[model samples]
Target: MKILFLDQSGKPGGAELCLIDIAKPYRDRALVGLFADGPFKTLLQQNQISVEVLTTQSIQVKKSSSFLQGLKSLRQIIPLIIKVVKRAKGYDLIYANTQKALVIGAIASFFARRPLVYHLHDILSKEHFSQTNRRIAINLANYFASLVIANSQASQTAFVQAGGRANITTVVYNGFEPKIYQTCESDVRQLQQELGLIGKFVIGHFSRLAPWKGQHILIDALAKCPQQVTVILVGDALFGEQDYVQQLHRQVTALGLKNRVNFLGFRADVPQLMAACDLVAHTSTFAEPFGRVIVEAMLCGTPVVATKAGGAMELIEPGINGFLVQPGDFQELAQVITTCLHERHKTATMAHNARKIASQHFDVKIINQQISQLLSSKFN
Candidate 1:
């Protein structure tokens, strides 16, 4: 079936990366209509996915935007909406990959008379989104979306709690190609040596540097960790979170952790970096809709410790496959890190279990089949 996928990001976030896998199966018949042009567009091109920059203008609405601000942005995006409506008519279904996409896709779907699927990636809660944004998202999905593909049970639950239709929402975890994460020993050693992490117990944190992402929490926990423990932060700030990025640098300095911390910025070699690390940490201060990094780490056969909330709780069973710590608990996180450091054999076993489970459940082929079945059943 012909499908039109809409995303608003100019950079590759978890949701945008997930969209790449979802669109791959329908590459010949699908078009990824991006609201802005940047690295994500380039990534689509590299993947051989049909993509187009639908609008040159930016959507300035933030998750905490006021209703007036949203309306102003909506006015600016009218032309984009018209453009999407014209394009939507040529597709069997319109799949919205982000919130801003949902806003435009909802209106376009109504005007174009096409079924719309809203992929819910974020937890629609007060911690993550403003009440106005949550209301807009839920109302739009309820009224215009034929189906809502939530990234996790946490995301699905938050939508229903915010008055979304439960019947319309279903959980679908982000998929990854397990083989992509299997780095050769020589490559892992080379990466470790290149990063000057040789003989250090390396910890990797792979998310955009944001306050809610809790990069500072990791830094704080790092200060308490053994001197042999080192951290490599793998992502850069995507939004206007430069201030938070600066704050993290200052925190690392004040805590005297400059030598132990490495800001690698945004690199395309995520799987290699993950495989080189001895442990991965997901230290989000708030409830994450889905911990994509956690699954990626698992697929890389690296032991992980994630904040114990939201979808993280679904992915990890403490001491079984991986470990979990309470959100924002630096002491708990530090302790977990120390435990993993001292008990290498135990963590290694857990990592093996994690890789096996992740390979079985979150493989890209399996996830794409699930999505295809859902789309076929709903839109056929």
Candidate 2:
């Protein structure tokens, strides 16, 4: 079936990365319509996927935007909606990959007379979204969407709690190709040596530097860990969170962890970096819809310690596959890291278990088949 996948990001976030795997099967018959142009479009092109930047103007509405603010921003996107409606006519379904994309795609689906699929990637909680934004998203999806594919049970639950239609939603975890994370030993050794991480018990944090993403929390936990335990932060600030990046640096300085912490700032060699790390940490201050880094680290056969909330609880089995700590609790996070550091054999065993489980449940092939079945059911 022909699909028109719409995403609003110019950079590759978790949702954009997930979209790449989901749209791969439909590459020959699908188009990824991005709302802005940047590295994301280039990444899609590199993969030989059909992609087009549908708009250059940024969407002005924020999660904290008021009703009047939202209405004003709606005026700005009218041309974008018209453009999407025109382009969507050739596709069988309009698949929206992000919240802003859903708004435009929902309206375009109506004008184009195509079924709409909204992929719910974020938790619709007060912590993450304003009430005005939440209501707008839910009302639009309820009225226009044919199906809502949530990234995890946590995401689905958040939607239902926010008065979304439970019947129209289905939980679908993000998928990964395990092979992509299998780094050569020489490569891992080289990366570790280059980064001066040799012999250090490295904890890798792999999300964009945002306040809610809790990069500072990891830094706080790092300060509490043993001197041998160091951290490598692997992403840059996106969505105007440069202040948070500055704050993290100050926090590191205040804690006197200048030598123990390294800010890599958005490198393309994620799997290789993850492979080189002894353990990975996911320390979101708020609930994560799904922890993509957690799963990716698992695929790289690295032990993970994630904040105990949202989809992280679903991915980790405490004391079995991986460990989970209370959200924002630096003490608990540090203790978990210490345990993994001291118990080498046990941590290795858990890493092996995590890899096995991640391969079995979140393999790209299995997830693509599930999405294909869903699309087939819709068409049939």
Cand. 2 TM to true fold: 0.98
**Whole-model lDDT for model 1 versus the true structure?**
0.94
Question: What residue pairs clash in candidate 2, if any at all?
Answer: none
* Model 2 regions lying over 4 Å from their true place: none
lDDT of 2 by residue, 49-71 (tens): 99999888888988888889888
Q: Per-residue lDDT tens digits of candidate 1, residues 111-131?
A: 999999999999999988899
Consecutive 10-residue window with the lowest summed lDDT within model 1: 68-77
TM-scores, all candidates, are 0.98, 0.98
Best by lDDT: 1
Give the Å error, residue 84, model 2.
0.9
Overlapping backbone residue pairs in candidate 1 total 0
